[model samples]
Target: MDPEVDTTQGGLRIDGRRPLELRRIRLRLGVFSQADGSAYIEQGNTKILATVYGPHQPRGKSVSSMTKATKGIVNCQYSTAVFSFGAGERKKRPRGDRKSIERAQQLKHAMEAIINLELFAKSQMDVFVEVLQVDGSEFCVAVNAATLALIDAGIPIKDYAVGCSITVSDKLLGDDDSGKSTGILDANWVEECSPGVTLSIVALPKVVDETETKSSVILAHGAGQRLHLSQLESLRLRALQGCKDIRTIIDQAVKDHLQIFVVTTALDK
Candidate 1:
């Protein structure tokens, strides 16, 4: 572990955020006039733009003959600006590389899990995400931006698939009122790239009865050092809380946009 990566600076993180404190999240929907739907988001220094198109005809690689018979299809493409990498890192070509393709596929599955694919039988939904700035929690930001775009396109979904990430520092702080481990939530590029366990989660941000069987988690991915079994639950709770908080922000943005649109239309009439 790097000595400088010590995130528990008196219970504060590298970016001056306390445990469970999320980065500043700002999002806007219907950002583009031509696309069926579009959105842009900024989480700390990580910024992403997502656009959604279609419920239109499914053709080419986006759909196959068999898929057209069974249900709708989703095609996701993720890309990064050439300058989006960290400042000191060598700038690489941003062509459809293997990493981007894998990220795209992962994002597509996350969206598919929430979408009512059966409703758009024989159709296709195309989602394109572009990373304008590079930072940690890249994948989670992509998932979030895409979800808002889908909503803007008026696609029906079972639930909001919110994404959040957490990272463990070399030391733990348990002096807070909760007396729980102060795990790092919403790591920045510097903290995330250093060294430690990092976990990313995408899930439905809903409260369900403990007696019920359904779960909120859709996907959980981890990288860096292996996390201990004991700490997993704590990390899960922090990430889930972050997800729930973000969902609330997105919902408010959508409602605000709608209210503005309604007022504009009323005046035009």
Candidate 2:
């Protein structure tokens, strides 16, 4: 943590937000005509574009043989534009980099957790995510964008998969009358770069039955900095809340998109 950096300034973050508040999220689905489905999302400074192609035949016999007859294959590629970084310098390479490869794998697993792969057995779905700007939480943003693209593609999914980033800061909670570890939701670049532990989570939140609610299933989680086991549960809860909020926002966007599409089609007729 920067000596001058305060987690909460006048009950607001450095960017003028409450500890639990999220950055402004703007997204659009079906952004690309050629792809089976596509979406673009902007979470504060980080912007990503995701496109999904195919529920078609596997490209090779090796892929076909490996894919179970009851489950489909999910392929993901994560890339960052040369100008993604705000700094003047450009990147030497994007997709082939080691970090990018790991992110691509992570994204694949996250999406696979929610998608109903059994529905399209022996088929393949390719998701490609391109980061236009990266201030923080690039992986989370990519997952969200890919989910929207999958929805646009009309792929079957168990539920919406949402992602959120959390950061823990003791000083942020020091102002409280009762001392407790403070968890900040939707951390930005500055907070992410700070000394505090940053955790990114992707989860699915939905009801199972009237009397019983299914526990929020965490599809993926990545952590930075050492975090104590004692604080893990609280931090997970905070991150879950962030994920719920993001899911609400995304659900509304999907509804809005459908309404607009319906109205446009009616008007055209």
Candidate 3:
């Protein structure tokens, strides 16, 4: 822990947020005119752009052959710009690297879990995510951006898929009061690069009934450090809450976009 890194002030985090608070989220749908659907998202300093295309013919014979008549094919490509890093740092390639390939596969699976593949059987859905800035939790931000893009394309989905990252650190857990073991929600770049266990989770937080009881179905979980059995439950809870919060934000954004779109179309009519 950095001695200068102040953990909390008046029950808020060093970034002036509560322990379970997420960074400010800003998003816009239909960002690109040429793509079938596109969205841009910013979670604090991390910015990502995602585009969706197809539900059309498969690009090549290999893809066509693999396509099932009962289910749609989902293809995802995740890339980061050369200047995505901070000052004095640069990437050699934008994509095709080992990390990028793994992330792409992960994004594909996440999208597959939520989308109604049966409706687009024998067709392909292409998702491309580009990281314009890298502050932290790039994978989570990419997943969120892709979800918005899919919605913009009017793709049917069972529910919203949200992603969140958590970091478990004793330093952050200890408040001035009772010092209970806690995890930080939505860890930033500095927290992620610090010494601790970090977990990334993607889940669909569905509200089952009017009572507001929510059930979270986790689609993916990735860990950056070894976690103890005793700490797993707490970390999972925090991550789930973060996912739910993110889902609420995204749902609102989608609704707002639709409202504006409807008003614009009516005026043009």
Candidate 4:
């Protein structure tokens, strides 16, 4: 861990932002006319684009039957462009890698949770989340992007899904021996590669439906380290806060998007 990376000093960090603060968020909807729904979001150094298609027909018969006639199926395929890497660096190929496949699965699961699967029935909705830039917490960034895309597509969801990552640092705690210190909030790549642990959480901001079954709700939680049991609560709370913050931002963006939609529709009329 770089002792110089400590936030205590006046030293400037990435984007001149302070520790525990998220990057500036920018969101745009209807980015592409070809897709049923499309959105783009920029979180700090990470930029992502998401597209939603379908609620139409299922490509395969096997999974197609899984969707109920009243409920729609969520078919997600997450990929990153070769140039989506930082500094516009070109990637060799866009797909077929093991990591990409796993990412697609993660996104599929997240989308399945929010979208009421029973509405479209025997139909499939394809969600493609693409990472245009990766600085840190790419998974969280992609999930957020996908949420906006779903909204743009006019897909009904129980709630918006927000994801966040946390990492501990050695030097930040002023004790290299205590490499397990918990750093609440965002963790860059350097912090991720260090001796610290990382946790990624995807959650529904608030359970608005009291009659709905909460236990069945999906909460994707990943922990890399065996931290002290006592610290678990704080980590969980902080991650939830991150999720809430993301929800707030997305909620506002959704409102703005709808306003634009109303204006556009009125003009067309």
Candidate 5:
């Protein structure tokens, strides 16, 4: 952490954002015509695209029945393009690698929690996320991307499955300092690859219902460095803020898409 990057003293930092601020966000729906639904989201230098296919026949015996049993099935495939600027200076296959498989599984689990599975039993929904650029919070960004795709597919979700990653870095000491820990809101590749602890959270867009029902947090993940239980609260709070910020941007995107959709239908009629 750079003292120059101090959030307390400095009024506002790069991008004119407060300490916990997120970058400007933009989302576009139906970017691809062939897929059932597709969306692209850009957050600073991080760019991700997601596509949905299915609510169709399941691939295997297990999947076919599992989906039909009571809820819809969400199959997620997460991959980064070999040419994506972030995967490090290398040439290699784009998907089906070990890392990609693990990412895919994580994504699937998170989505399963949000989607109303019972509605489309015996059917499958495929969500494919492709990283166009690499930044600190790829996994979280991919989750955000997948959420949009699901929405585009007209899938029913209790709430948006927003995701974000928080990094705890050392500020006072050198990069090696163990005691200097500062929690960063959203990390890009440089922040991610650095020595630190990262926590990923999948949270529902918080809502204050007059009905007096409390909101729920679905999934949380701690990776890289082990953090004390005491630190969990702060980390979770930061992650939730990030999720809320993402949800706002996605909400705008959805509205824009719907407006256009309505206009097109009106014209057709």
Candidate 6:
């Protein structure tokens, strides 16, 4: 863990952000007229495009086997452009590579958790995510982008499923050095590569109403380094908060876009 890259030092990070600060997220919905739904997003320097199709009959044999007995299946294909990486960074894997395949499955699982699969039983919904640029938190950005695309495609979901990442650094919770670890939110590539535990979470947008709760967390994945059991709760909380924040941003963006679209259609008519 190079001190130069550690954002958990109770100081601003390398990119001039506080520990819990997220990169600026800019997104547009329905970017492609041909697809059922499509979106483009930029989270920090990571740019991604997502397209959604289907909710139609499962045609291909590969898709047929994956269809659930009663609930429709969600299929995902994830890829990164060959030139998406920064100069001197490692080249990206080709499409259908093992890494891409695994990420595709992960994205698929996140989508399946919120989508009303029973609404289209014996069918399939396909989501495609392309990483146009990579800076960090690519998967989180991709998840958010896919969610927007699904919404643009008019898919009904129980609630918004958002993704966020948290990284626990050497910072201690209390005064002493031996205190419990403190986790930071929305890790960029530098923090992700730093020597620490990075936790990626996919969760439904948190609601204050206790009576309105079903499940808060949909998925939690740990990477980079091993974390102590004591830090898990704090990390989970931080990630969930990030999910809630992201969901708010997305919700506002969608509403703004729809208002603009409504005015544009009115003018055209």
Which structure among the candidates has the greatest TM-score? Answer: 3
lDDT of 2 by residue, 1-269 (tens): 35224544676677777778899999999999999999999999899999999898888653747544678889899999998987766878978999999889989888898998878888889999999998888889899999999999989888988888888865443133556765788877777776668888888867555454344755656556788888778778778878877887898999999899899999999
* TM-score rank order: 3, 2, 1, 6, 5, 4
**Residue 24 of model 1: what lDDT?**
96
What C-alpha lDDT, on a 0 to 100 scale, does residue 215 get in candidate 1? 37
Residues 1-269, candidate 3, lDDT per residue (tens digit)? Answer: 35124633565556676768899999999999899999999999999999999778778753657544678889899999999997879999999999999999889889999999988877889999999999888899999999999999989998888899887766564232456557778877777776677788888888676456474655556556678887777777778888887988898899999999999999999
Report RMSD (Å) for each prediction in the order shown.
3.3, 2.6, 2.2, 4.3, 4.1, 3.2
Residue 27 C-alpha lDDT in model 1: 87
Best by lDDT: 3
- Please provide TM-scores, in order, for all candidate models, with all chains considered together: 0.89, 0.90, 0.92, 0.84, 0.85, 0.88
Candidate 1's C-alpha runs over 4 A off are 1-10, 66-68, 171-182, 207-215
Which sections of candidate 4 miss by over 4 Å? Answer: 1-4, 7-15, 61-71, 87-90, 173-180, 207-217, 221-226
Off by over 4 Å in 2: 1-9, 61-68, 170-177, 207-215
What residue runs in model 5 are displaced by over 4 Å at the alpha carbon? 1-17, 61-68, 86-88, 172-182, 209-215
Candidate 3 segments whose C-alpha is farther than 4 A from its true place: 1-4, 174-180
lDDT of 5 at 134: 77
- Model 3, global lDDT: 0.83
lDDT of 1 by residue, 65-137 (tens): 6453767888899999888886666447564888888888889899999999889888889999999988889
Clashes of each: 0, 1, 0, 11, 15, 0
Worst 10 residues of 1 by lDDT: 206-215
Residue-level lDDT of model 4, residues 73-123, one tens digit each, is 677777778877656468776866887888888888889888888777777
Poorest 10 consecutive residues of model 4 by lDDT?
Answer: 210-219
TM-score of 5: 0.85
